[model samples]
Target: MEETSKLQAEAKPMIYPSNGKAKEALINEKQPEVRPVRGSALRQVLVAFVANIGTINTGMVFGFSAVAIPQMQMPNSTLPIDEDQASWIASLSSISTPIGCLLSGWMMDALGRRVALLLVEVPLLVGWLLIATAHNLPLLYAGRLFVGFGSGLVGAPARVYTAEATQPHLRGMLSALASLGVSFGVLLMYALGAALPSWRHGAGVSAAVPLVALVLAAVAAPETPSWLIAHGRPKEARCSLARLRGDVCDIDGELDQLTRGTSISAGDGKSRSDMAASKRQTEKPEPLIKTLFKKSSLWPLGILVAYFVIYQFSGVNAVTFYAVEVIRAAGIGGGDSDYLTAVAMGVVRLAATAAACILMRRMGRRPLTLISSIGCGVTMLGLAGSLAYLEPGDFSILSWLPIVCIFGFTITSTLGYLVVPWVMIGEVYPARVRGTLGGLTTCAAHLSVFAVVKTFPYLQHLLTRPGAFCFYGCVSLLGSIFFATLLPETKGRTLQEIEDYFTGVTPTLGPPKENKKKIKSKELNGSVPV
Candidate 1:
């Protein structure tokens, strides 16, 4: 093990700057730039573009029910399903998400982020094709499962890759960009669903976008340099870093940091032995799972779970999936009403997400989350009140109220739940278990989604639509309080700084200074150890 570690370290490129000094010398020579280079910015944009395609695809699945519901309710239609059975089509996607999450998490750790991402396209393409071609319930269910699997597989790796690649200072903004992509995708799907003549056509069109995204990702996306360094391939790491950083930017200092973090020293053990030990340890990895149960990790996890429950139960999914039905139940007329409401909700969600990106850095994570939660709770209460008092036949009052409430819900969701939870999950965990933990949390959240989507129709049937929404409002209230108390403020902090904050350690915010006398003494002693 020791010999292998030494050899791996020795194989690393030992590049000295033209100024004839170590790279750290250059870092200490000036303050680090606040802004990233053009290449890094471009990479951020690309990551956002790819990552949000999954969200858009998920939205497409949700919107499918809107189209399917009408078909199921039609007088002469031969579809063998009621509203409850039809809801299963959407719920099936959520159920499949957790399975994909578990698989992708392990695969990402074993393979690499790029490989995990590329694999997702397989399920995604197949799912879309199935949905596009299906004439029966069984094929439709199979297609939705595939789409869910592909989206889940892509989620964690995309976030981890984007977070690892960008400078820490720009992390929030870049993360927000990914969220914006989700909003953009949702909006696009909503618009397409509204404009298209048939559900299958809409599904096909949505499927085509991800196919394009898959090709672009395969062709242009660079493998994360951090992953290469972790696997003891420093030369390859350097090349990947160069490709990501571009020609003019110097990556030697960043490379050193990556090496220092991942290096297995002679005193540590052999690389192969460490790998074996790691494999064995992970084979029965209790500590990794237990970390989420620790006091330090628990609050963050609770906050995430609470946020997701609120986000799902706050009736956003209900509206997104059944907007037209709800609007019709309120006595609004027109076959296009559902699609129109969906498009409007998507627009509001996009706007709200944009507002969140602008405000998140300034207000900090906790404050914005608190505000959004409280706002959503209030809006939900209003929705519940309007639903309860207004009779079904009162078209004048009932028609616009549901639409307004749905819009309110979308805006609040954008501000608080939709994007912030994802950003927090990416930020809060320790580097060693970040990917695994994030995937686990996402699985838990989606399980909640599975419950809500599957049971919502039944719940509405059992206790009118007003009762279902009222229950959601109460959940939103509890979630608001939980988030206000538990989540920490994470606005301008670096990744290392955020890690230190969670673990109760002080981070070194800047490079240490060299004392002139100490340096002279070291020079006289003929060497200095860093």
Candidate 2:
């Protein structure tokens, strides 16, 4: 402890970056040593905010079909879409999203996370513009495809950026903010869908969000320190770290730890630089396929892929893409009230996601997900039961059951299943192949979404609404078992620590290990604190 204090007392203020370049400063030995201060949580939040702004546009893309499909199906509509075309319009984005995820994975590795985010504006703007002016089926299909591709591109980078940039204490909340942005965007679209005269106007207005995201990414956000260090730009990493941490804290220790990588321990024979040099000299670069097949990659990949399958088939995309139809099937409201209820659901989701940001830090991941999954199962089963057994005139008295169930499911799912997986996608993977694995997981996710959303209409026809609800409910309960048995708690752990767990090495240079018992407890039985 005394030696730790001495080290802390000897620390110096970090040099902040300016105009994308870090200004270097020499330390004066005669000057008094400065102790490290806590990092600025405010700057962390700002960077998180900027990184995730594009998610709002993502929300708009998903919700657009909800409004547009109903509008296009109306009598005397110009671009009349039958059920098949409408399903294509909604599901095409999922098909194209995997392409975007692959591109994002490669770009995040090659160009950097910030650059990947900035480049996404091109697809988003073009897609929204196409949707705004589209006059025919093919044009509309093309527009939705473009928007889905852009939406896919935005997700991984934003989550990865927040995870890498912020301190661990703030990581969960900041990372969860990405989902908050998506919820707000969905709400914004729902409002626009109700208030605007046409879906075209809504699509036109939605383009403005990506433009703002571009400006924020270009002007306000810095490249993540992890990316800079991985690319051998240690100086730039230090600068970016300094800026994110603000002038109050000494970043030298953190910077050195980052440079050393996660493998360093007390008895390590060689430094990280020596290891890198030896590997470069002795071996060929490992093929991407080999990397993908590694235990570290496959373990997390399997969990995420299965979780995403649960998330999509649990009726999330079905609710999101076809909210009006689902609500109508619930038989509570008529006409404009259904849109009003959709907006209300959006508001609930946004608020619940905000609560999740707080709860994530307080309640941890495992418990909230368990609670959420169980709640989803209960609510969905309740909805199905009510739909199945209730007499037609009985709706007059128990009229609130369907809508209540819908809202309950929305709240429950948003709290954990919808939001936490996105956070895990950013946190659980090893940094060496984070971009590739993240994209694959995201690709898997969207593919599941495509399958679920595209087949939902058919499922409703074949199984009927009650049967469909029963299917989703059963899936949610079964998924809770996965959460219980397989999922690891990531709350309060640094991204590096989480990665270390998957790699099966004790993290010697990461966050404090006082919480080892907590992590162990979480893993053993998936228990949460009271």
- Candidate 2: pairs in clash: none
Candidate 1 wrongly placed segments (more than 4 Å) = 1-40, 76-80, 261-299, 330-333, 392-400, 507-530
Clashes of each: 3, 0
In lDDT terms, how accurate is model 2?
0.83
lDDT of 1 by residue, 1-530 (tens): 99999987775544445454556676666755432222355655666556445555655666677666675567865555776567887688888988887787777667877777677767878898998888888998999898888767767777777676665545666677556766776677667767776667777877776687677778776777777876678898888777766644547656775555421111233443234334533563346567656654665566677677777887767766676676666455567775676677778888888888878767777777766677677777777778788876676745577667667777877776777887877777765566677777778877877888888888988878777878888777787767776677776555545555565443222211333355345335532222
TM-scores of the candidates are: 0.79, 0.86
Top TM-score model: 2
Candidate lDDT scores, in order, read: 0.68, 0.83
Candidate 2 residues lying further than 4 Å off, grouped into runs, are 1-34, 263-289, 507-530
